[model samples]
Target: MSLFSRRKLSEYEPNDHQYQLNKLNFKVTKLEDRIDNLENDWECASQGESFQLANGIDAKEAANRVEKAAQKALPNELKKAFDEINSAVKNEQQSIRLWQYKLGIVNGEPQWVRIYHIAALSRELKKYGYETKLDSNDSDGRFSSLKVSWEGKETSDISKIDPAKKYILPLEDTECEITDSVTGKAISHEVAYACPRDDKWEIIYERKIYSDAVVVPGKNIISAPNWVKSIEPIEAD
Candidate 1:
C-alpha cells in the first residue's frame, strides 16, 4: 500500500507542472496581441489618419502646419520692426536740427537764428514789410534756414551778431494787476517771457520785479504776447 501511494503522488506532481506551463504560454500570447495593437495605433497616428490631439486637430498635420506658418511670418515680423526703428531714427534726426542755428536777417542785419524760432521771427518780420520763407536749397532737400526778402529782393548779406540778441522777439509788457490774497490790495506783478508750449504760452523766465514787495520767481504763470494772441501757434514744421 505504501509503494502504491508514493507512485500516485509522483504522478500528480508532473500534472501540476504541466498546468503551470500552459498558463504561462496563455499569458505570453495575450501580451503579443497587445503589442501588435499598439504598433497599429502608432502607424495610424504617424499618418494623421485616425489619431487626434486634445483639441480635435490631427497631431502630425497640425505640427507641420504651425511650423510652416511660423517660418513664413518671421520675415514680415522682422521687416515691420525694422521699419518702425528706422522711422524713429529719422524723427530724432529732424528734432536735432531744431537746435541748430540758421542764417536770417533780424532788423535788417544777418544773424544766426535758431531753427525752431524761425516761425516766430518770420511773423515779427512781417510787421516791417519783410517777407520770410523757409529755404530747402541746401545740400539736403529740407528747410535748413529762413530766406528773408524785402521789397521783392532777397537778402543774402550774412553777418555775425551778438549771440544773446539772436532770436529775440519784440518785448511786450507782461505786468498784470492782481489783488493780493494776503493784503487784499491791487498789486502789480511782472511775469516772464512767453514761450510756445502745447499750443499755449508758458512763462519760461521771469524778472525779479514786483510792486507788492514779494519775491515769487518760480511761480507758474501762463501769459501770451499781444501778437501771439492774434496769430497761430509757432511750429518748426
Candidate 2:
C-alpha cells in the first residue's frame, strides 16, 4: 500500500507513533532550512575570499612587472645622459685648447727644426716688444744676427737661460752678409735677449750681417707686419 493511502478514519487510533512522526517531520524541515542557510553563507564567504586573494595576487604581479621594467631601463638611460655630458666636456676642452694654441700660450718652444730658416722671427720678436737691432733694405746691409732685448717693466735675467736654445734662427745661406756695397753703407744690427741668467744685457749671437729677403710669418706664431724685414745668416763674431 502507498504510504499516503488512508484507512477508515474513526477506526484508526491516533497513537503516539503518529504524533511523534508529525513532530519529527517538522524538525527535519527546520534542520534542512538551517543547513541551506548555512551553505548559502559559506558560499558567499568563499566567493568574497577568492575575489580578495585573486585581486591581491594580480595587483602584486602587476606592481612587480612595473618595477622590473623600470629597473631594466634605468641604467641605459643614465648611461646615455652620462655620455652626453662627457661629449660636451670634451668639446669644451677642445675649444679651450684651440684658443690656447692660437694665443701662443702653449708650453715649450715652437718646432722650427724642419724649417731651414725661420721667416718671421723678427716680426714675432717685435710683437713681443723685442726691438730689432738691425734694419736694412739691401741684403748686404742686414745684420747677420740681431740682438733683441725687452725694455718692458717685467724683464727677466738672461744669463740663467741658455743662449743656444733661445729663439734659434736657421741660416738660409752660409755666405750671407748685410752690406750696401754700392752705397758703401753697412748695418750692424744687434738683437736683445730677455736674460734669464742675469738681469744684465749680453749679445749671445752675432752675424757678419747680410739681408737676403724679409721674413714672413709662420703658421703657428703671430707675426708683426713691417717690423721684421728679413733674416740674415750670422756667424759667431
Residue-level error in angstroms, candidate 2, position 64: 1.4
lDDT of 1 by residue, 1-237 (tens): 699999999999999999999999999999999999889889998888676446786668788775555433333322232233335445552111122255789999997653333444444445434456755455543346544444443221112222222222212332334568999897654443334566544344333342222221111121323222222222111
| Residues 91-151 of candidate 2: C-alpha lDDT, one tens digit per residue | 5521100000112323575431211011233333343334544333345322233334433
Error at 114, model 1, angstroms:
71
Q: List the residue pairs that clash in candidate 1.
A: none
Which number leads on lDDT? 1
lDDT of each: 0.43, 0.35
